[model samples]
Target chain A: MSESDLEEMFTLAVSVAKEAGQIIRDAFDKEKEVDTKLSAADLVTESDQAVEKIVNTRIMEKFPTHRFIGEETTSESGEKHELTDDPTWIIDPIDGTTNFVNRIQEVSFSLGIMVNKKTVIGVVYAPIKDEMFTARLGKGAYLNGMKLQASKITDLKQAVIITEGGSSRDAKEVEDKVKNIHALITHTRGIRAYGSAAVNLCHVAAGRGQGYVEYGIHIWDFIAGALIAKEAGAVVLDPTGCDLDPLRRRILCACSPEVAKGLSQILTHLDMGCD
Target chain B: MSESDLEEMFTLAVSVAKEAGQIIRDAFDKEKEVDTKLSAADLVTESDQAVEKIVNTRIMEKFPTHRFIGEETTSESGEKHELTDDPTWIIDPIDGTTNFVNRIQEVSFSLGIMVNKKTVIGVVYAPIKDEMFTARLGKGAYLNGMKLQASKITDLKQAVIITEGGSSRDAKEVEDKVKNIHALITHTRGIRAYGSAAVNLCHVAAGRGQGYVEYGIHIWDFIAGALIAKEAGAVVLDPTGCDLDPLRRRILCACSPEVAKGLSQILTHLDMGCD
Candidate 1:
């Protein structure tokens, strides 16, 4: 996408995100009726649906031709959708649904645009904190109107990282995430679990945390923030060292190139499963 | 321990914390010559020393004969000092030193006052984020002048938790922390790792996250924030279900009492090491 096209998309994303955030915030203030999906650990709330509906409506009204994907609507069908050959809009109205439902206030709106199967424009905004993160391919990233940059933390010992495992109830899945934790504990300065992939990636982009890794996250949860981190001069990689599968995505690490390479190598050495 | 006395002590703690935060911020913006202790992951920076020096000078001058326990000077001697009566002051000049050294911006100044060897006043200040958390015995906790309270998350599956495991080099220790995570993931809404104990506990107190659990942290890392969380009506417990230790503490959880009990039970049922 051209720079002007990216700018327009980002502007539209910011607007949609704000509109969705207002809906989420309104639902958050009202007493929420919480429900679980698959298991108790996997939470879904009325606010999530309410916010997603708003975002979806906004996008559909503005760009009827664009391919749109949303977590609440699309993921249930469990079908793979390609981000290639056209501009595809990916939306996560409430990326941190648990945070939203519990009124923890770290929830965010994550929106990304993919051109030719690659993320080219992205915006992730945390309205509660009033922090906005935006990026376009080759245009650099910005957080709250200032250009973002990763830290010059070269050594693992000096790097502070954000990490989390899946919310899956399967013991083996939990064990896999634990194995990654086991590999990282002594190798890095410290690990932070901020509970939201989108915000955690924004933190890495803003130099608030050196890196972030999570297993089994959807594309909507990461595409926007990962693009922002990448444009901010941080490296974004699949923890498995393979190209990220946008449709059936899982593990990811966004950090400075040095940290990303170091972490990827360690995860590789330990035979940790990222898929 | 009187309310008035606690308020006065809280004021002193806030003052000391702000001053210490300024000292650390000044060093952060200046040159950093970092040194390591236990390993590369254990960092001590000039900022840490400078903040400690400033806090110690101010407290000693104000209280004259108050006993002080600090991370820098005391831990440097490799001597473990127990908390004392006679109005003891517990200080972590820069908790989350790794974050400080890495320029991750989650570090904070933590101060806690113990009267009769029990925490009575607690303050934590993160200058970069401009977040100030303070509390006194029975006066309740406040963040940025707003009263703080734990979230009323009764169900474990609906809870959003934050935690971090220490160096995973020790397979046994890593396994123990993982066991806790294993149980938590199946029950909580999600898990987060925010890197700073002071900040994590404060987040819990502010109802940002339901709870925070961490392994292998010192008293200075959690003393003030734990007390603050307790004052906010959150239960602070060692994973073993014992009251959080006043000295050389490790493996702790801070959350609403019911949630804490539920989490403790889960960890126990899973036969984790803490129990």
Candidate 2:
């Protein structure tokens, strides 16, 4: 894609994020029609579907030939998304739907654009908190227009890690994740869980925390925030210290490589398989 | 104390919190001189001591006869506070010092006034986030002047819980807390950790999460938040379902009694001895 083409898409992505954020903000305090998928912790609200539909429509209308992959669409189809060399827009319209349903303030809309199977642009907007994080592949990330930079802390002992108890109810998966959580607490200064994968990544980008690691998330849950974090000079990788596989159901992000490596060694990495 | 006295103290408490908040916000993004108290995870920054000193001086100036207990003072003196029937003000000048040092947004100034050994006024101010939570005995809680209420969820399986990996690095303490965390993740819809006991309690009061439980916190850490949660119609109790002993160093807060009971049944309660 040319620079002008990417700029146009980025503009569209930001505008669509604002629209989705408005929907999320307006419905944040209202009674939500919430449904479950996979497990009780896995939530989908009316706002999720509504925003996804509106965003998907707007994307297709402007870039008719562009491929689109969205959390709701994939869940509805019950199929794996096949990536291609062509420009593709990936979205998790409401990244923290459970937070939205529970009236927590970490909810956001995540969007990432990829060409040649590599991310080129990213945007994440948390409507309740009024934070809009944006990034281009070469340009630095920004939070509400202020440039963001990850923390300079390099030691695991000085780091505060963000993690999650994902919606997976599988006993073994839960146990493995629990082991990782224990390791995090034992090794780091502390651990925090904000219940949103996208926001967790953004937190690392904004230097709110030193690192974030999670298992059992879809590509849409982190694709955008991964780019944003990377643009802010953070390291994004698989939990095993390898390059992040977007389709893989896990990620390890840190402000520096030493902390990333430290996290990888300590975590009981769960092989959650691929998308 | 009379109603007029309580009101006067409440005014002073709120004002002191704002001043402490100003101190916190000014130093939040700056380089911090961090120190460790109990362990590597137990952090104390210069801002913590500075805020505590300022708040203590302000409180004593306004109410010279009232007794005062603060986190920094207790830590510095290495002495336990004695709860009494006289008017007392308890403060955690920087409730989440670790977060403050790490530039996380969960840090706050927490203050509570107790008369006849009963709390009458509570205030928590998160300077970075600009959330002012306040409550008075027999009065409802408010966040930034808007009335607050806990969630109505009653079932553990349908609820989200807030917890923490506290600053304790004791091996047994870590194991026991991790076990409780496993139980929480197994039973609840989800779990979140924002790294601040006062903010965690206020989260439940504000309906951000259905419940919050933690072991090994002092009266200063939770005194104000406990009252805020109670005033917002939440159940504040010991982890074992008994009355909350302000000095007990453990607390369990839930939006409803049923959820509190359910959490109590599932938790592997830790007997973190009194302050």
Candidate 3:
């Protein structure tokens, strides 16, 4: 895509995020014990679907031949993503669904535009906290119009790492994650769990913490935030120190290469498989 | 103490919190990985001591007969507190010290007043977040003057719980806390850790999450927030299902009695000695 096209897409992405954020904000206020009833599950799905459909339609209308992928759409159709060298818009209508359902303030709407299988524009809007993080492929990141830079801590023991107990109940998955948590606490100054992959990446990018790692997240959950973090001078890597495979369902991000390598060494890398 | 006296004390407490918050906010921005150097340790301790001395002096100037207890004073003097029937002011110059050193956004200044051993006024100010949480004995809690209330969820399965790994790195203590974390993930919808006991309680008060429980925290870290959570219609208790002892170093707070009981029933309670 041309620079003008990228800028236009970025503008649309930001506007679409605000619209999705409004729906998320409204639904967040209404979330409750409805998590117990299967029928009432639509309470969240309804808003998710509404946002996804609107976003898909907007993308189709603006760029007639562009591809679109969304969390709600993928879940609804159970279709595998077809990433190609085409202009594709990937979005997570609501990244922290549990936080949304629980009324926590870390929820966000994340959008990333990938062309030639490389992200060109990334945006992660945390509406409740009013933090709009944005970045272009090589440009630096920004939060609410201010430039962002990751903390310059290179020592792992001096770092405060952000992580999560993701919503997987598989016994082995739970055990592996718990082991990683133990390692994080034992090695670092502390461990924090904000319960959202996108928000966690944003926190690292904003210098709120030095590093963040997680297992069992989707491409739609961290793709945009990963770009933002990278643009903020942070390293985004696979947990095993390999190149980041977005479909791999795990990520490790840190302010410096040393911290990133240290984290990868300590973590019991879980193979959560590809998207 | 008379109602008028309580009101005056509450006013002083809030004003003192703000003054202390200014210092904390300024210091938080300059915080770094100073944990590695004994000299750099003074970076945080200086702010803590300055805030404590200023608050102590103000209390003495206004209410000479009132007793005072503070985290910095206790740590400096290495003396046990002398709790009595006399009206006493308890304060933590800076809660979440780990977060403070790491430049995370969970640090706060907490103050609570107890007369005849019963808390009458409470205030917790998170400077970085600019959240002022306050409460009186019977009146409801408020966050920045907006009325606050905990979530109304009763079932553990539908609730999201807030907790922390804390600063303790003892082998057994770490093991116990990790065990409780595992149980929390298995039973609740999710778990969140914001890294500050005071902020965690305020979060519960604002209906941001359903419950918050932590061990190995001092009274100054929780007295104010406990009152805030209680005034917001939440249940505050000892982890073992007893009335909360202010001097105890552990706390368990839930939005409902049912949720509290459910949480108490499934965990390895740690005995982090009293104040």
Candidate 4:
């Protein structure tokens, strides 16, 4: 795609994301009716479905030939979807559904466009904070139109990291995650879990946090966020210190390359199982 | 003090908290020079000290005879200040100092007034989110002037828990915290670490979360938030299942009586070491 095409797509993604964010905000004050997905803890709400439908429809209307993948629909069948060479739009209409259902204001709407099997445009809108994070492949990332820069903290001891205990409640997975937390807590300044991968990634992009790592997350959860963080000068990669595979479920993002190396080293030694 | 006097103090506390919050907000966008206190990870910024001074001056100006305890000054001398029969104001001018230093928006200004050795008024102001949580004894909790209520989740499986890994990076403390996290992750709907004890407690009070647990925290870190949560109908206690002693460094707050009972049961079995 041409640079102008990518820019146009980025603009469209931001607008669509804001619209979806408004839907979420409107539904937030009402009573939430939650439904279970893979397990009792893995939740979905009517607002999730409603927002997904709206976002998917709007994107398809703009680019009828573009493929679309959304969390609420794709995860229902328990099948993992892949990004193809053709242009595709990935949407997590309501990232952090658990927080949304619980009436927490940390929820967000994330959207990304992948072309030639690479993310070319991304937008993550957090309505409650009225902060819009947007990025294009070559263009730098931005939060609310102001340019963003990742933190310069290179030492792990001064870094504040973000991670989450994912939807899985399996005893073994929980134990492994806790162990990883134990490993990092001693060396890092602090650990935070916002329960929203997209927001956490954006915070890292904005230099509010130094790093983020999580496993068993889906592509729709962090694709847009990864792009934003990458554009903001962060190193986004898999735990194995390789480029992220869109189909992979693990992510390690850090503000600086040194912090990324330290995190990767710790995670590799721990060798936690993939979901 | 009479009911009207307590009410007046509550009003004064809220105003002073907002003034302190403004000080924090004004300083937030500027350069932050962080200094360490108890440990390297335990940070203090110029903003923290400046805000504390403003809060202390404003409160003391109103009540000249009232005693005052602030995190920055009291902790510097390594003194565990007790809540006495005198009217004492407990202040954590910037509760999430690390977040403040890092430009994270989760910081807050916390103030609680103790009269007759009981918390008679409490206020927590999060400037970035523009949320102010306040409570008075025998009255109730309010978030931005609206009444607040804790969630009614009784079952552990449906509850969302909040916690923080404290400043201590001791091997034993890290292991115990991880174990506690592992134990709770299996039963709770989700686990969140906001890195700000005051914000976490207010979240539970607003029904955005169901429970909160932490260790090695100080009176200034939680005194205001505890009152807000308690007035919102939560049960705030120590790990030993007794009322929180201002000097005690452990806290376990739950939204409902049954959730508190369940959390207390689980925590008692784990028996994590105190800092």
Best by DockQ: 2
Name the runs in model 1 displaced over 4 angstroms: A1-6, A268-275, B1-8, B29-31, B167-171, B268-275
Q: Candidate 4, residue A86: CA error in Å?
A: 0.4
Per-residue lDDT tens digits of candidate 4, residues A69-180? 8888887766657568889899898999888877777899999889998998889999977889999888899999999999988998889999888888777777778877
How does residue A164 of candidate 1 score in lDDT? 74
Q: List the residue pairs that clash in candidate 2.
A: none
Evaluate candidate 3 and give its CAPRI docking class based on DockQ. Answer: medium
Q: How accurate locally, in lDDT, is each candidate?
A: 0.76, 0.94, 0.87, 0.85
lDDT at residue B175 of model 2 (Cα atoms): 95
TM-score of chain A of each: 0.92, 0.99, 0.95, 0.96
Residue-by-residue lDDT tens digits, candidate 2, B1-275: 67788888888998999999999999999998888998988989888899989888888898899899989889989887789998999999899889999999999999998988899999999999999999999999999999999999998898999999899999999999999889999999999999999999999999998999999999999999999999999999999999999999999999999999999999988989888
lDDT of 3 at A158: 75
Q: How do the candidates score on chain B by TM-score? A: 0.90, 0.99, 0.94, 0.94
- Mind giving the per-residue lDDT tens digits that candidate 1 earns over B72-177? 8876787767656688888888887777776767778998888887888889998878899988778899999999888777766667888776533455666677
Could you tell me the lDDT of residue B61 within candidate 4? 83
Q: What is the DockQ of candidate 3?
A: 0.58
lDDT of 1 at A20: 80
Candidate 2: residue B25 Cα off by (Å): 0.4
**Worst ten-residue run, lDDT, model 2 chain A?**
A73-82
Count backbone clashes in candidate 3.
0
Q: What are the per-residue Cα lDDT tens digits for candidate 1 across A1-275? A: 56777677777888888788777766765677877776666677777777778877777787787888888887577666655577888888788777777677778889999988888888988878778898988889998789988776777756777887656667766777776776677677767776678988888888776888776677888989889988988878777566655655554555656777788777632233321
- Model 4: per-residue lDDT, tens digit, B122-223? 899999889999998778999998999998878888888998877777777777788777777877888998889999999999998899998878888899
